[model samples]
Target chain A: MAHFEKASSITEWLDQRLAITTVKKVMALEYWIPKNINFLWAMGMVLAFTFALLTISGIFLLMYYQPNVDTAFDSVNYTIMSEVGFGWLWRHIHGVAASVVFLIIYIHMFTGIYYGSYKKGREMIWLSGMLLFVVFSAEAFSGYMLPWGQMSYWAGMVITNLFEGFSPDIAGGIMNAPGLVEWIRGDYVPGQAFLSRFFMLHVLLLPLVIIGLIGLHFAALRIPHVNNQDGEEFDYHEAAKLYKEGKTKESKVIPFQPVFLSKDVFVLGVYLIFFFYLVFYHFNFAMDPVNFDPADGLKTPAHIYPEWYFLWSYEILRPFPKDPGLIAFGFAQVAFFLLPFLDKSDTVAPANRRGLFKYWFWIMIVDMIVLTVMGKLPPQGIWNHIGLVAAVVFIALFVSLPWVTKNENRA
Target chain B: MKNELKILGVVVIFTAILYWGVEPFAHTQMHKHVDGEHFAYSDLNESTKKGNVENGKTLVMGAGACTGCHGIQAVAHKAPMDAATAVSAYGVNPPDLSTAGGLYSEKFLANLIENPAHALKVEHKFDAAKGKMHPMPAFYGAGGDKAQEIADMVAFLKSIAPKEISPKNAYLDACGRCHANRYGKLDQLGETPTFKSETDTLKHKVAVLEYQDKLKAYMGKLPPDLSIIIRARSEHFLETFVENPQSQLEGTSMPRVGLSAEGFEKVKAYLTQTGDPSKTAREAIGPWVLLFTLVFTVLAYLWKKSMWKDH
Candidate 1:
């Protein structure tokens, strides 16, 4: 047991039992952040804020939403939008947050890669973040099904059909790919059973998993501290001692509280301006026009596409024949998790400092953008050829990452 | 500081490129541009400009025989038979002509009265194998100069229409016969009627089923409910489509209902109301929220500077 002074304040009384003071010191007041980091460091906090917004707004929507296929469309478009007061505000917040969260995640991801944040001891941070991304993707897909609209039905049909690739030929007979698809849907096609199960996953199961992974992500960050722009190392214990001795100017670190938090608050304020602008004025981009129609399994939309966030991977799947395309898509999903091992370079430096690695990084970025652009276009004429080339470049870039960085000089 | 600006510049340029590619360029590729010639209802508009309203009313009530099947509710002209009788006899209930003048383009109305199949663009529906012609007969032979008489009737119908109609009323009058507005709580027969007796309730249910079946048979397939049509289609597509169904979709069972420019606006207003009721409120509050956030951002910047002054 640790010695303590007599209790005088509420914090002291709680500290005796819960060690509340120690927790504050460990997580906030005494936690040291490198002084050299920039505004990109605030992206994690932005993502967390977005997740909180999504959770709150989603709860309000859930109050009026019907999980049954027969009433789902009416419940959203009529009951919530027209009957409930200020219901549209909640929906707009949820819609904008769902979309903007992905934007922040992508920025956060590229920031990590640029600073070599996944090098050595920081692998768990990157891995946990990737897990969160996968779960969030699943959550978005499930939530989209709750609307029971034309796009929702057809996108669900298209995505669920991807499981057919799991079935393979054995002994000159087809395996039960059709059975596997039916099992996931709980029927031969997406229907009442499918809607109910997706509602359960969206509202309950996936959220619980996401919350758990968020905890792990933050925990992973605590151990490695945070990566900085310069990728420089310091003796944190000595830096903290200097910081505490009223020699703040000489210290290489600052406390996570007032010094770091002030910048984060400023960034958050800027981000909220952008966010609410979308929520109030430009919300249509987040909503697909075709989703307004009631779901009819018999009729397919003239063009079926996923939300903008999923476009790059969707493009990868489009350029090849069925089996090879599935393989490419699977590779895209799992490739990021293997990033810590892919770049064999010893030094943890920014891409610009590394010779050939800089070109690799930029080419990879441009290729992804090309893939995203090609994804939304109808795969015909020049677009089909462009998509195929972009997809191939995407695969080749990742496969060549190790070789490109192996011969680079240390920073 | 310089590095941050460089990064910001890169982000801005990247976003601009993505926006251009996904929005403007991709849109042009997906939907081909329709020629302006399709929207020019020229000849019909010319005839309608010269129409005589009094002459139109006399012809509509007397020689036209429109009151036999269709009702002119604004002029107190009722169809001889009720809705149930008409559905049984002709396979679908004929729409009342209370707002036809304002609801349809003048050209569409003239063309429709002259040649029902040609104007409706359902010449395919007149299947010789099925021994079926369109339910309504052409008032005049397909090729003739009955433009003046058609223009006058359109003028009479337009004259009796209310100067300002509610979007809900406009939707019901123009599109309610074939299409249901489920989001607005409207069916083909308008609001569902309440019954005092169980027998009457059962009778209403049976009647609705029979009406739907007959309508399906007449149109080949049931017309899609118009609850979300506003969001599902672009404004340009809807305008050209309503002006002439064949201009967008050839051989469609839908007739050129020919709403005057004003009538189509009202119907579109109703659809927008049902589909996106919060659009006005959302846009109204947008700037205020942005202003508040901007002020907060400025204050936060000042606070950050003060906090970091020592370090």
Candidate 2:
């Protein structure tokens, strides 16, 4: 009962576990972070926090989830509805945490790009980060299928069918292979095979890969440190001086330990509240009832909408004219994987940036927005023309921006 | 160095706790169980009852065994009059017992089932005028005691028969083996036959106003042609044909009718005899074929074991 009676024992325990060693202490809180970093810098921590939250919530959710087609949807419902000794609190936390995870990552990515965080020594970090992004998308999608609802089933159909559009050269002989289709489909249609495979990918294989890759990402981040908004390296001495001088004491940039931990708790609480509201009060939040039915090739759902993340992409292909739009759609989807290559920023900070590539960068953004809108809208005559123009402009800017940025940097 | 040790210590503790205490709780292996939604007709309210149609199912499938040429209960297929097809297929022009008795009375059917010769007198007259009766067997053997059983079966048929027989069922029932295209073959027949349409494919289909005429013509019998196949003759005569056809009729040029229990009942209900019994010497070849198959399987297994003996 008197565990902390002696302060020395507690201090010794803390020192053995959490305290920084002398050598590592030299590269402590004042060593890497920039002094003038803004709220945008908080995005990375938010992203990290989101990942941790998701992992915890995910573990709890996995307790009750069944991953087969016949049971997947019901398992999810049970978790949300009947597994209520815990007030369905864990499920809500997980559901909300997933959306927040995406929200934080999106913010983090845009912050990195806008501030040119992908430059120089940070390239490995950016690459690892991009890989993490891909893994996250895959994890989300596989998780979507585990629910085995109507949206989940049709979404799997829609997304998997996307691979069909790939040229045989790129798609390989897998699709054309005999019995491969049966393997993918499991039965003659989407049933136990698809759900169970997706379940394994979502819960087991993908998560393992994600954990390893995330470790690499963090290691890479440690190599060069977090890139700041101003292109120069952090003036740590000044930051330490300010911290000692009471200036940072009152500043918004708080220490990550206690203060940010509390903030994360608060944000997590907000997310939990919303999650429960949806799970219990509106459990069918992201679901479509029609998706509950088995997939029949004879009947198609009236409208197929991709998950929210792919909405922009889906919108891009919709209004595309038959001939050029097909190619445009291909290029647009391909561009998602090609994003890290498309934006060429040689500097880590915006303050020291110099380039004639800004125009091309703006053009890329405009084109993407246009393409996204085009994909969302139903096909019409003028929209088709706009889509054509958007596609051409997107291709132009996509190719030109990196070249222009690199050239100007060289100059 | 101290900071590094501290960090390493923390990481070790985290991983140790995770791997030991947390992992098992995190990984709760659960399997999916579908909430089955089976519906029972017996459980339904009076207004909503699908009725004891299953009785007809038993008669057609169990005693009748109409599935030989027709498809199984779950799988829909057109059936010929052979045994296996009779149990499975819903029947082309064969009249699905699931809904057949609505058009004809049980007594009327029982009378017909008693004697195919008496019942098919009209069609036989037609055939007689054309030439000789089509070697059709006289089936009415129920005598006096089994008439009510036949009537109950016909009642079951009236509840479930399809309103219309499609060209697919009719073609499959009457001429599937010999013909590929129902429309194509019918066009060549030079008759512009009334049964070639999309609707008149099944024998006891509800939509048919002239189901009796079509069924009589298809069965090669006449109105009130009961011939009591279920009562007079060995039930196995119908049962074997309904369950397995190739055994009952050797080189039997009958179309493969995939008759479901409902279809068999409808046909049975449609066929109960009305006149005196004319006992014809009909042989049941099913037992011989069954015995042959069993011996053959046993011999095949023995041969297989002998082949593997050297190995």
Candidate 3:
């Protein structure tokens, strides 16, 4: 939070001109982070690294990837896999990184919630992150559609058709475009226009939004020092005081560089090794095999599941009818933003936080995992009931947070 | 959050050890039963011992199971009864062998003729009628000149009726046995194929489903259409694997019909035509992929170290 240190002449000059010192103090090497916050704090750094990797790999893939319905699958199979040198490597990295990045983000989000980083001062962080999650999901769905494979085709059909509830044709055709779904798709079914639009959204439009949001998210995070596990030193006044004074020996918080940067870089190295293992050794682990076949609207696969990261939500999507399910899904994320407000727990540290919150928190985690597993199975027979129950419990965990906080005793 | 960095470091070390540990195990486990002594196509001397197609046509017409279940060229007094009535008497319903030559590899056919259950990897479960477990009896040594006769049979199948003779050939060569070929245009069964779309493949599925009696006659255990089988089994395993059931999978009832080494080659040629014909190309491309990955890993490691040094 140090704006100026009266150190270097170049820095001083830049500060006089454009307040580079202020910028540096806010987010750069001069930014101060809590020294006690360990590797758990590095989750954001890890996510940023993976996002950069995904973006780079995705750019390389975009160079050769054809977003035409006719050539999409073949372009991936022949041009990308065989014709272009190391194109397969880049494609694998992009696809695997896309799935892996969600995993890292979920863990990162969990860490945010586990500590009370999302509470009060950091509510904007949670809201922006949730918005980013929705945008990224849209990006993923669009990217998936660009492939024009079987799952991609059906997924495009199923998700796009959710908009049918709002379409004039579904109602009584009172006003606008009678076939809005067909108009958006540009055909009776998913075809060239769908691929083109999805490609544009996946590569161009959504990334800009994500980049903008990330800037704001990081900026917001900088204002509030990271919450530690045992959470004690939470003082906005102290942060302002430290910002006024360049150096503080008494405060335990350290600068971003040297202390945190080394640990972040080290964790990133380990993460990359696992990344390569998935890309090289388990290339098809995250993908559905039916994607190899080209799209045929006449035929559908026996089971159609979204990527695993979306499984928990997809599980929630089951058991209810489409219209309400869509609304439920929308409300679910909207409810997520209210979590910080719902959690009326006193202490910032989960360790000292009294009540049934810790137990409830664990139940939600296990519930999500259970729902994820159930999503992969067919939504029939016993699974219908399981999904219904899990979905109820999932919503209950978040919705009843305020009530749970009121009723529960101190831990 | 406390001692978590040390925990992460320890996890990384263990992961690295585990990562390095898995390569050799993967290499060994990739093809677990790669028996060295097994016969390959290279072992057979096909030049001097060319399979006589003429002799094969004769054996196929007159052989015990050949004439009984299979009708190759012509003259088959339809088995006194279809498989259903016969299964009651013999506990097995044999499949039509019109496309047998194209469906099975020469080695597979030879092994099957010599030792049916062993070749097909099944057991002689006498109680089960018209079941997969019912034994297929050995046919190679049944006659006076059984060995040579089997070779000729295999040659006839391989050369004359390949699973897919060419992209232009009719798709019927393999599937025509169990499934009927019902094209609206007659005499087009032998005509050149020009499939610009999946409609051609879809037509095959419809034609196969048209034979309700054929499917029902096998009782509950319908032999899966051979159209997809070639894609499932490989050549080398099908070669050394044809003669003995115990060498590979045990407990299944496909009887042996012995064929000589030359006959085995013919069958291998026939079945492999449909299944994994691009195997050589896939194998050729594999090494380059491995090399690229290994080289990039080293480069990534060096770059990672350099990036972290400043941090």
TM-score per prediction, in order, is: 0.94, 0.48, 0.63
Candidate 1 per-residue lDDT, tens place, A113-153, comes to 88889877999999999999999999999988888999999
Q: What range of 10 consecutive residues in model 1 chain A has the weakest lDDT sum?
A: A167-176
Where does candidate 3 chain B have its weakest 10-residue lDDT segment?
A: B180-189
- Proportion of native contacts in model 1? 0.79
State the lDDT at A408 in candidate 2: 53
Residue by residue across B183-296, what tens digits does model 2's lDDT show?
Answer: 132211112345676666553244232433433344443222122223323334554454333344444334223344444444443332111111110113334434554555
Candidate models: Cα lDDT each: 0.84, 0.49, 0.62
- True-vs-predicted CA distance for residue A289, candidate 3, Å: 1.1
Relative to the true structure, candidate 3 reaches a TM of 0.63
For candidate 3, write residues B1-311 as lDDT tens digits.
34776746743563343333223332233333746344343332232245788777677666465666544442334655554454444444455455456545566677566655545444444333555443355664535566776777778666655444332122333322233222211111223245667998667445434343444443333433332234334445455455443455455333333434544554455444433233354456656656665665566556545643432
- A49-163 in candidate 2: lDDT tens per residue? 6677778877877878877656665456544334434424555556656654664575566557666777677778777887888788889888877766556777787766554
- Residues B36-133 of candidate 1: C-alpha lDDT, one tens digit per residue: 34445653434435677997787778744677788888888887777778887898788888877766776777777777766666777765347777
The deviation in Å at residue B116 for candidate 2 is 44
TM-score of chain A of 2: 0.75
* DockQ in order: 0.69, 0.01, 0.07
| Model with the higher DockQ, candidate 1 or 3 | 1
Off by over 4 Å in 3: A1-26, A166-180, A234-250, A321-324, A407-411, B5-148, B151-311
RMSD of each: 2.8, 24.1, 11.4
